[model samples]
Target: MANASSAATLSICSSSSSSFFSHIPTRVPSQFSFNHQKPKCRLLTIRAAVYTAPSPTPMPAASSSGIVLVDKSDSDKVNRLKSVYLEKIVPILKEEFGYNNIHEVPGIEKIVVNCGMGDAEQNSKGLEATIKDLSLITGQRPVKTRAKKSIASFKLREGTTVGIAVTLRGNVMYSFLDRLINLGFPRTRDFQGVNPNSFDGHGNYSIGMRDQSVFPEIRYEALGKTRGMDVCITTSANTDNEAQRLLALLGMPFKEGAGPTVLLRRKRKKAHHFDSKIKGKK
Candidate 1:
């Protein structure tokens, strides 16, 4: 009986141990479990792209004398009036004036083109048109001329734009002069010659054009209104005689019998007539 009882106790203990082992979960190995296993990484090979720049075209080499021999097609041609002045006018003036040196011969210093707009403050479009026309006439850009002081009579305020002007020098001056002489004057109506009395006492000449349409650059149909312009030619000449002579040689057409001597005589006669009237009144 004792042997049988001990055997029964051993069987019960074995059954309980087997049931506890079944309730506890078994763990998978770290190498084979998806949750703990690391994935194999593969190395990728990439190739870099190479770029090459094209070579530049060779430029014409300069000569030993420091002169670059450029093709005529590639270079800007010289101005015709400038060439004439250098080759022809200079030598003629030197002989005619009996100048001691070539530098002593009077030449044009600059040209000032002015267009006054009394109603610029009121007519903004006119002012803009004037600026555009002036710019077209002169190759250079036009600058606004502002009123220096307020004028009650004219209703002009200080710093208000009253006019536009352009000062041309160098090659541009020569080109403008050439065009004015060759094209502008010839296009004017009933034009015999320019006024001989328009020279200032200080070797400068002024020309007033009644119509801006005289210039070929201006389109008559496009104009909002007709405008006038004043052209003042400044020269290096010491006296009016020298300046007038210079201009005459350069194809400036002066009125017949309107020389400096004739103008001087007319001035003297006017002065004498005024003196006679004063004496008679006394």
Candidate 2:
């Protein structure tokens, strides 16, 4: 009876031990694995983030392009006034209409330079001489131009401010432009092309000429002497935007696709820009 009881107790303990071992996790020497029976709960948190980049800058328009801008110095209105148009208008007319040709557009007000001398009493004798000199060159009297002095400008310096402009048709503007460029600008050693944004919104430009002879680069030998000019071209009074439109129509190289509205910059200025002419020590 004692042996039977002992045997029964041993069997019961062995079975319980086996069941506990089965419920506990077991590891193999070589590797281990998970059952993964439960559904994944982390999928709801995943999301895609949207991102974007900026656009590129466009180039300048063409029509408003011209020469260097000179600082206006203190001088009388007449001395301050220099019209590049006076120098080239005839040529433009000739180029478009063929020699001595003038294009007549009745609606647009013709640009005329004014000396605002008020009355003869205000017009000094010196003014008379200047007017006579002007008369000899331009057949028309020095009528007042519709443009006013730049308000921010301190004062109109005599022989300082020069007016530059372009008044030619697509075809004529082209022909005269060839002549002016060929005669005016030298082949700058690394010349690319002229800036399209030289003009204001009103399609006008006034830049300084180094000298009359800086142009006339027809032959290498002819540079020493040539009749050069300083001038400006102005448009019929309108908004700056419309002026840009007119210049684009005339073939000014606006950096942007169609025409010049604002001025264009060739190379961008960098944060660490340096001038070749100056010592970069500082």
Candidate 3:
């Protein structure tokens, strides 16, 4: 009985040891295996995306052919002063001047408006104001005139802006002249006729205004300073006589006892005196 009991106890101990060994795995399963060559390392190259801006679209080039088209309807319409010149002034000039061809009759070419700023070096604002006032008066932009050379006596420097000027031609010239003759001159205080002797030897006439206030365009209250202006009327005439006649016919008021006849007489006297002097010298 003791030997059978010992055998039973030995069997039971071996069975319990085998069950414990079964519970704890001796070899890892295929799912958890570390022998699969580490998935070949794969060097995961994470390519970062870079942003780029698109190029601007090119603009269409302008037409190289410099052809300019004019409107016929607009060209047909004549300016007020232009029509007057064609209809009335042309015939009058032809008859009076004994002009065989109508083309020979002299006409106004252009008008130049100038404003000199004597104190431009000292006062820049005055220069600016003069430019503004001139533009207002002329209905065109005035170009700033600069000193060509430095003048110590006048305190002027080279390239210093000392004046402003505007040149008017075509319909604009006629319009401005008409306005100046009819409106501007009449508006002056203690108004008198323009100087008849203001003609240059080269058939150009000049008129000086004391201030720009005479023009309807300028506002007296808005003006910073009283500015003077010079108006030079250039003509296609051959002589001062022709130019004077042309201007007088176009409604330039001359002072009493100072007309083209007087100018002609003065010129004749000067020529006669010059001739006499030459004879005496001989």
lDDT against the true structure, per candidate, is 0.82, 0.41, 0.78
Best by TM-score: 1
Clashing pairs in 3: none
lDDT (tens digit, per residue) of candidate 3 on 59-145: 222123211122343235556656666755677678877999988999998999988887877888777777777777777989988
Better of 1 and 3 by lDDT: 1
User: What is the Cα-based lDDT of residue 132 in candidate 1?
Assistant: 90
Candidate 1, 29-147: lDDT as tens digits: 88877875678899898989988888874543444432223345433545666665665567767887798999998999999999998888889988888899988888888999999
Q: Each prediction's TM-score against the native?
A: 0.65, 0.27, 0.63
- Cα displacement (Å) at residue 124, model 3: 2.6
lDDT (0-100) at residue 164 of candidate 2? 24
Stretches of candidate 1 exceeding 4 Å from the true structure = 1-78, 261-282
The candidate that wins on lDDT is 1
Give one digit per residue, the lDDT tens place, for model 2 in 131-153.
Answer: 44333333334433223544446
Off by over 4 Å in 2: 1-178, 181-189, 207-219, 225-229, 256-282
Worst 10 residues of 2 by lDDT: 74-83
